[model samples]
Target: MADSITVRGLSADAGQTPLLRDVSFEVRAGEVVTLFGPSGAGKTTIAMAVAGLTRPGVSLDGTVEAPARTGYLPQQAAGTLNPARRVGHALGELVGLRVPRMTRAQRRARVTEVLRAVAFEGDLGPVLRRYPAEFSGGQRTRLALAQVLATRPDALVLDEPTTGLDAGRKTELAGHLGALARNGVALLVVTHDPDVVAALDTRLLRVHNGVVTPSEAPQPRPTGATRPSVSCSGSPAAELRTVSVHFGSANVLREADLALFPGETVGLAGASGAGKSTVARCLAGLEQPSRGTVLAGGRPLPPLRRRTRAQLARVQYVWQEAAPSFDPRRPVEVQVAATATRLRGVCPGEALAEAREELAELGLTPAQAARYPPGLSGGQLQRAALARALLARPEVLLCDEVTTGLDTNLATHLLGHIDAYQRRTGAAVLLISHDPHVLTGRANRVLTVENGQMVG
Candidate 1:
């Protein structure tokens, strides 16, 4: 079979600064290829170049031969779907694009067929009627995959396809990708997920310092290691009593109770749409609880809108969707430094300096932090979000899927910093993740949530 995509000494530069350099690779029919690297290493740039998308100031050099029929799955899964349109309707529209002469009935049939091909086992009628936000994280990912596949592309470029999925769902997705390759669909995956790398037998290329070279596949980190010692003394840092939250007609959380003692790490685990995110949002004051009370520093916390700046600064939230947390129009340096200005009364000059230092610690350079959300990669945005939260010196930190886009080496390094902060400041942390291994040794106590209930 002829090669589906080919790159010969391809280099990418954003204005005068280079992102990728001297990259050459090929993906033949029925082959899976991955570009693995640390955050801000230009993996996404290469993927975007392969998918024939251009960045604002980024220019591509050298030769890239791409097939006419191609599909692209972006890193931000939620952005792939239309929020206002029903799932089935959005999918049918895409099918219509590929099969322009097909009738409405024919389009619906094609949508259903594509959904089934992506292994969507849910009831088709109700699921199809729901909007994109109504779908769980895993379901949203599957729907995104279906959207890409509905176009009937010969090659697919997926960026961080396995992020936010649990072990089982990750395995299921890997199996699906493998089967797709077997059916002669070439796949070029850009990710840092070791599990995803291990699940596929493919050509591995590492991108770093604006270059790509052949490399061995990365290995997963060993779990159940020694955890940081935390002295959980005095009153709990934060507490939620029988919290209940509702969105429209959906009961996202029902009478859920949780407590975070100072210096303790608590893990929240659940299936996608099982209310893990709801709890985190409630704690962060982003989502209001319809019933029950929240306490911070052993006192009843005020309403989210009524909370004072001090109260708000005490609890910081690192969003699971990193890019959305930052303003797209403003440079990230201003946005990140603003946290310190509001919470600590620091001057802009001093706050910027602090933000720069923290961002550097997380592997982001000053130049990278100066870029807007649209210019930075997913991992860089995630790190910047963490830096903003840490700058506030919050007493309670709520991390929701913050490390999903990170490579293993950087993820481990970032976790070490969080552990150190918790130890030094006696801050309480509530970590929410779908990967069981992420919580294995880190969390002092693990709670399992199901159908809006804290089952364990």
Candidate 2:
């Protein structure tokens, strides 16, 4: 069979800076290829080039070809989906050309078929009618996958496809991808999840310093800290009491309770839709609870809008997608300093100094901090987001899958910074992640969430 995709001496760049250099690889029919690299390693850039989305000035050299049909799932599923469209509507649009001559009943049947293939079990009657905002992050991601699969493309390129999915959903999606490969679809996945990498017989490629090279072995996992839990003699830093969140009769999260004491780190794990993120949002005051209460430093959390600046400053959250967290039009220094100015009462000059210092701690140079979000790599933005949160020195930090899309080295590096920062400031940390490796030996305690309830 003809090669499903091929690249020979592929080099790509944005403006004067090279994004990927001297890369060569090929994907055969029914083969799965995995790309691994730190955040700015150009994994996504390569994926974009392969999918024919790279823009002018973002030049590409050498030969790159895919089959006539292709499907691409980007890192940001929510952004990829039209906010005004329902799940059914999105899928219909994707497969519309093929189904243009079909009846309404026939189109509905195809939509249901693809949703089932992607293992989506939500109420389609309502979910198909509602907009993307009505669905949770995980639901939107699944819908995005379903939309891609509906096209029946000959090749699939997924960029950080499993970043926001819960473990169960991750497994389900992996299984579907494996099945698609078995059916002769060329599969290219850009991911950081070990489980995703382990599931496929893959052609592994590693990208670094704007270059790509083949690799035989997977990246090594981090050896996490094995120390005893630190002492918390005073009041706990943050505590959640029977917190619950429900969306339109669907109980996304049950009465979940957790406590984070000073100088402690707690890792939250679960399958997709297990409510780990819901709990994080609730604790960060980004989402309100349907029932139950939350307390920080022994005081009840005031209404989110009514909370004092200091009270709000005590809890900071680093989101999974650091790009959206930033203002694309502003310089990184301005974005990072906004956090410090609002929460730390620091002037621009002092905040910039502190931001630079924090960025240095995360392995970024002062020069990188002067650029905008679009110019930074995946790892740089990840580090910058963490620096923004740390600049305020919040007593409790809520990390919601912050390292989901990062490569092994960068993920480990970022986690190390989080550990060091927690130790230095004696702050409490609630780390929400789907990767068990992240929690295996690092956390003081681990909580497994299943079907919206906390178990052990």
Top lDDT hit = 1
Which stretches of candidate 1 lie above 4 Å from their native place? 1-3, 101-106, 225-234
Task: State the C-alpha lDDT per candidate.
Answer: 0.85, 0.80
TM-score of every candidate: 0.93, 0.91
Best by TM-score: 1
lDDT score for candidate 1 against the true structure: 0.85
Per-residue lDDT of 383 in model 1: 86
Model 2 segments beyond 4 Å from truth?
1-3, 55-57, 121-130, 134-136, 166-168, 219-227, 230-233
Quote the RMSD, in angstroms, for model 1: 2.3
| Tens-digit per-residue lDDT, 1-456, candidate 2 | 453988788888766777778888888889999997667778888888788877444788878899888888877766778887767788887777766787888888888878877777766687687777656566667778778888788998988777677667777878888888999999988876666777667888877777888876575466565357777678889988998888877787889888899999988888766678788788788788899998998988866687788987899888776777888788787788878899878998988888888888787766678777776765578889998988878999999887766766677788988988887998999888877777767788888888889988
Which stretch of 10 consecutive residues in model 2 shows the poorest summed lDDT? 218-227
What is the overall TM-score of model 2 with all chains considered together? 0.91
